[model samples]
Target: MLITDDDEGDRRLVARALKEGHLSCECVEATSIEEAIFACSEYAFDCAIIDYRLPGRDGLDGIASLHQRFPYMSIIMATGQGDANVATEAMKLGASDYIAKAQITGGSIRRIIENALEKAAMRRKLALQQEELENFAAVLVHDLKAPITSVRAFAVLMEHSVGAEITDKDKLIGQCRRVANAARRMDDLIDTVREYTRADGQLLSGPVEMDRVIEDTLSNLHQMLLLRGARVTHGRLPFVLGNASQLAQLLQNLVGNGIKYCEAAIPTVHVEANPDENGAWVFAVKDNGIGISEGYYQQVFQPFKRLHDKSKYEGTGLGLATCKKIVERHGGRIWCASADNQGTTFFFELPACPAIA
Candidate 1:
């Protein structure tokens, strides 16, 4: 907590009130707005109380400056006289709350501080949600353009050759196939987007059997596995509390990625789980395929983020992003460890189901 008051008496009074209130905080004193800004740069303070009168600038100016720099910090304006105009302007300048000097008792101060902190937390959460929505919009616009453009171009070409006596039948057939493939890509992207959004919905949680999830996942990807000549093996897995379908989708995406990115004649993937020290189930999906570089580990989980060219590997690029959302929804976390040219191991931790009595 920071206390900014040019008057030494007022500063000491605020500190004493905090102590009397039994509020456990490391209070930092600043005599001016400049000092308060400097103190903030030096230490990460959660809340600040600024006197209406300062040396060079008033409390409203200080509130605007500090809010601009650290938008997440909670700020309270303190004034000797309760001027409604000043209070309204301070709020517009991002002051979380306003308090009069007469009400500087331990109880009132504590209540004001708590309310400011809660308001600040809500503002931060809303900011983060807005940022995520913007990113989602940008990804959709950038990724969907390519397939849509391809479909349009191919359709135009086929239309141009519609009435012309086609000398080459194979060429027209190839154009038709291209149009079909582009349409399929667009359909796949839309389906993945739906799955990604659905992961955020309320989970119908239960004791999901890992063995059954893996079995169903493999069955769903049987044709892809056969075509790629990939092998997926797993040990005796454990039961975890999560949504059954989502768990299946999570495993399917990981295993499919392992097979899709491999260059080996016969790709291989292994899934296993063990109990961690915290009694949670730590699961790993190890793959013997072309691996990811250390630097791109974090970026790979972002939506529509890809490391390879579309011609070489085909995907909507939402697989890992969807997996991350699913794991997080289940109150878990997922990450990967790998090196270039070496194999990769993806690890996720989930709560272990209690033993049946």
Candidate 2:
């Protein structure tokens, strides 16, 4: 923890009060903003308590600089008596909390610090939620707009060429196909979003039979596999502790993506598992496709993030995000390894079932 105070007596008083309050902290003292910055650079402090009055610059001015430097660190500004305006401005300038130095007590200071920490944590969580909501909204708009635009364009062409002497049969058929594909894309977006949200929060934990899940997933995606002429090969997969339905969905999404993104190449996907050092099974879903770039390895797992053109690869972009959520729900980690054109392998780990152990 960092404490900045210009007066030696006030600094000592704050330190003594914290000690009397029985709050154990590795406190670092700083007399000015520069000293505080140096201390912050040297150590990772949980919170910084700053005195309102300083020699060259006041605490309110320092709040902005400190906040910019360490945005996540909680800051509590200490103001003198009857300095309500200063306290208010400190908060506006990104101070987490403020206290009047005249009213300082051991218990009051401890409670204030605890309150600041709790509020800071809540703020960070809200920020993350807002960002996720914004990302979803942006993607929803783009995905929805693309299909509607395609449908409208095709409809306009068909209407203009209807009953015309120069009507081309092949062109009309091509336009109808485009319209049908666009409608399918729209329907897929709605279905994917519905299913993604439905299973997102539901955690069904059990001894999930790996073989049964794979068989069911393959059955569900059989049509797509046939349409794409994709072949899946797998060896013996071990049973693990997880939700059966979610695991099936996870594999289905991976396999579906593997087939869809192949760019005319015959899709060949392999599913295999091996035991890790910690008794957990590391499963890999390897696919021979037009692989993803190294920079987008993590981005592809984000909802509605697409590295390729939507026309080339038809999807709501929620498949990998759903897979990630499922893996996290099962207390596992997921990652990818791939080059630009060289195939990709997605690896995830799950704990072995107790019976198997």
Candidate 3:
């Protein structure tokens, strides 16, 4: 797992504890926050143990960066000094757990790592179960709504033929149609629930080129690009460590996002990537579409949330939320930068996959 600490003594202590406990954790050492992130490029680990007191960098800021790229990887902060307030801030900044440096040990260290790993496993399992339930509910709703829609259609046809002179026929048909429409909407919601809440299926990992992943993601969204008249361009990107299937889904969500909410005449989405000051990969998907309001920036990631009315747009609202899940699973964080009508940029950073020899 990713291990970062400016304290050489402390780093070794934690490493030995993990080893002695037979945790199978390879301690990748980092003297600074930037170096710690670079270590991610070398290999993708299941968790990250960071020093809350990294001397030069505030522990919380470092955790924020790591959390964005490595959302799925459990991270704990190690600090020698702190009250409840500092510990609270660390967790707010996305730390999975907190450990005081003075408290580091073989036995405690083993337990911490074990606990984090176990928690990750539990979350994945829960997601799978939840997706199965959603899929089942969606199917049930669809079956129930079919007859309602047919009834509404027949009512409309009779009303149209009978006209207003047919007494209560028009009003009765109108009411039936409204009820049918609501049922159809519930059907849509059920489907979105399944789409957004649906399990990510599964992922297969390997050394994949970034350009290839982008191409594949774009290919899947060919229909959206045509409909929205949005064009995307980016420079050559180097290979990063991750599952190609998961990465494709990641890009699909980003591009589909450009099509869904933007009200601009022509939407333009741009993709770019580069090695940061630290060697990790940072990629951005910028769009010249309708920008999201500041207040909704964080809320947009919440499941089943939409900034617009359902009448105005058709979506499961689970798209970006799902994107957030995928990014975190790969040890990355995702956030948006946008202003009214200026468009928005959804950026995420993932550590480059370590080169296999």
Q: Candidate 1 vs. truth: CA RMSD?
A: 2.2
Write candidate 2's Cα lDDT for 145-174 as tens digits.
989999999999888878574468898889
Candidate 1 similarity to native, TM-score: 0.92
lDDT of 3 by residue, 12-59 (tens): 888877877777756678877888778877788788888877767767
TM-score of 3: 0.53
Q: lDDT (0-100) at residue 184 of candidate 1?
A: 93
The reply for model 3, stretches above 4 Å from the true place, is 1-202
Relative to the unseen true structure, what is the C-alpha lDDT of residue 231 in candidate 1, on a scale of 0 to 100?
Answer: 93
Q: Which model, 1 or 2, shows the larger TM-score? A: 1
Off by over 4 Å in 2: 9-28, 33-45, 56-71, 78-93, 97-115, 163-170, 202-204, 235-241, 263-266, 275-280, 309-312, 351-356
Range of the 10 consecutive residues with the lowest summed lDDT in candidate 2: 159-168
- The whole-model lDDT of each prediction reads 0.92, 0.87, 0.77
Prediction 2 global C-alpha lDDT: 0.87
- Sort by TM-score, best first: what order? 1, 2, 3
Residue 248's lDDT in candidate 2: 93
> lDDT tens digits, residues 6-122, model 1?
888998889999988889999999999999999999999999999999988888999999999999999999999899999999999999999999889999888999999999999
